[model samples]
Target chain A: MESLLSPVILFFALGALAAFARSDLAVPEPLSKALSLYLMCAIGLKGGVLVADNGFTTELFLAAAGGLALSCLIPFGAFVALRRIGKLDATNAAAVAAHYGSVSVVTFIAGNQILSDAGMAPAGYMIAVLALMETPAIIVGLFLARRNAALTFQPRQDLLRETLLNGSVVLLTGSFAIGLVVGKAGFVPIAPVFETGFTGLLCLFMLDMGLLAARRLLHARRLTLHLVLLAIVFPVINGTIGCALGAVLRLDTGTTTALGILAASASYIAVPAAMRLALPKADAGLYLAMSLAITFPFNITLGIPLYSMLAKLMV
Target chain B: MVISVPHRKIEILVDAPLLRRLRQLASEAGVSGYTLQPTLGGDGDQGRWLDDQVTGGAGSKVVFTTIIDAAGAADLLSVLEPLLDEYGLMVTSSAVEVISARS
Candidate 1:
């Protein structure tokens, strides 16, 4: 209950409400993008400072490997479920599977807030986990999509370049590196904007996210009940397994919960672009609606708390 | 002074990812050149769509227009026809009299 009432969460809720009511409320695109960059930088620096304090250990390596493992494995699970449960053909199933397999950067940022509110600090190296998780799902998704079919369409030469150098990944990893370099002493000068002002900026970004998510949810006709149920269920099943993986791997509770959230998140941004490029015949409406409308909202409002609870129990 | 050579103007509104392939196909079909324009959003069979959002969803809606000689346009259509059956693309072409002056 207390978790649900956190200010950042509430602001997210309010933004969602305004959107549902069809309010004209908005955050400018440039401003929203800038805030996103600021938040990523702030997060990266915080993590870097922590690593500078704690120093490197084998655990960081293990956590990163765990993240890569989940990103690769979850799509196979999704492909099976989509094939058996959703009864989608190879292309559509693969498309949907890819989405479920990748991490949402926005969700990770939101998860950071939830963990902070819960008095847990996620490891900065988790940003690497976040970055590493993006591509494997895409590879797995494309392979599954083309598994049984005669391939005709070839993706653009820039597809891999776009995926690896996506704005979000670049910004997140760039900040992480800077954070490591700057460490604690450097954290002080920028603390005013990146620290004290962080929450306010987060609220603004959440507001924009809420509006986008709600507006997208309004056009949900293409999502069937089976797909919708799978959308909700995938996160829970995958999230639990992920949490357990983190616990077994002996990650701290915060990092464990972060892992669960990353595993559970559905990529709306990166995967969608890749799918459009690679799987032209796949149903864009079906996949996008599920990730943006159903899965994203659930993770924002309820899934975060649930994952945190499981992380607490396991840790 | 201007020359009035006959040509065909081909315009296609397709998801952005398809733009590159379409460009390549147009080039192979011998188009002189092409222009890719971004639309804010529009209504279609699937529903309403917007390019306004910066979310991952934003990149899919685009308009690709190319002009080529009439024979070349027909060849391009032949290439595009099969591709269209598989992707969500709306294509239209019309005969145009080129009104530009060139030596």
Candidate 2:
């Protein structure tokens, strides 16, 4: 319950309330985008520092492989479920599945904070793992989209290029590699800028996210309720599988919870932008609103706590 | 005397997918290219425009332009009319004098 009242949670709630009330309060788009970049840099740097402190190990590589595998596999399961049960056509189903398969960096950031406040420590290489998980699901989604199509075209090449080298993925992975190369001595001079102001910046960015999410939800009736239900339920199922994998991997409670959170979080940034170019037939309001508005809030606010608690039990 | 062809510039407000399809169709129909711009806001069958940032899809708008021969415009309309039955598209054509002949 104490987690619910933390300043971070409170700020998120305030943003949500402002949105629900239809207030004009919003964070500027450019600033929000900048804040997202800043958060990625900070997390990457911190992860690099942790790797330096603890020294690299084979386990790190194993964890990264695990993360990548999850990113690739989840969408297939989600696509099948959404198509078979939810009655979504191939294009929309693939779009939403790609979302669930990718990671939400904001949710990961929030989960790290929640774990730290609970006096638990997580792995640093998880940052590298987060970046690794962004692209493969999109590949899978594209394949699923084209498999059922009657006519095949050369759009796959363009789609692959976009997914692999998209802005967010490039920034995130490039920053992580930079952090690893620079290590502690390199980040020492810049820690004040990246580390000190991160939380405030996150709050501001999330305020913008909240406003965007609310606006999307207001236009939500256009989406079928079946898809909405899938959005709400899919994350919990993914989190369950992640927690089980964490237990098998023997990750510490904190790291396991964070992994679960990462698994549960869905991508609203890079994947959606790529989908716009690749799957033009997919409805944006359906996937974006469901992922950003519905699933995102649920994961950050309640799902984090629940996953953490479950991690504690398993660990 | 320069002969001027009286033509109709058909304007279509279409969804992004259909807009792309229409553009290809227009190009195939022998109409010289067209111009497409980002639509900031609009209202239609989906409902009122809450805000621009809210919706992620380009369900916004695109304007396709071509000063086509009257017979070609009518033919293009025939192909599009059935597709627009289930989707959002508004087609209107007006008479204009074209002297350049290539436009």
Task: Give TM-scores for every candidate, taking all chains together and pairing residue i with residue i.
Answer: 0.90, 0.80
lDDT by residue (tens digit), candidate 2, B16-76 = 4345557766766667755666554565554433324322323345666666778888877
List model 1 lDDT by residue over A1-315, tens digit each.
Answer: 776787777887887899899999988777876887788778777777777777787878999999999999999999999999998988889989998999988788888887877789688788878888988998899888778555575655746755777677777778878878888898899899889998888888888887877777776567778998999999999889889999999999999999999999998877888787778777777787788778888888888888888998998
User: Who wins the TM-score comparison?
Assistant: 1
Report the lDDT tens digits of candidate 2 across residue range A72-155: 899999999989878988988898899899988888888887778779767887888888888888888888888854323324
Give the CA lDDT, 0 to 100, for residue A168 in model 2. 67
Residue A91 in model 1: lDDT: 88
What's model 2's lDDT at A300? Answer: 80
True contacts kept of each: 0.34, 0.05
As a TM-score, model 1 comes out at: 0.90
lDDT measured at residue A77 in model 2 versus the true structure, 0 to 100: 93
Q: List runs of model 1 lying over 4 Å from the truth.
A: B1-6, B21-33, B57-59, B71-82, B97-103
* Top lDDT model: 1
Q: Write the per-residue lDDT of candidate 1 for residues B16-102, one digit (tens) a residue.
A: 756767777777777767888877666666666656445543345778888788788889899898678677679999998888887
Query: Which stretch of 10 consecutive residues in model 2 chain A shows the poorest summed lDDT?
Result: A149-158
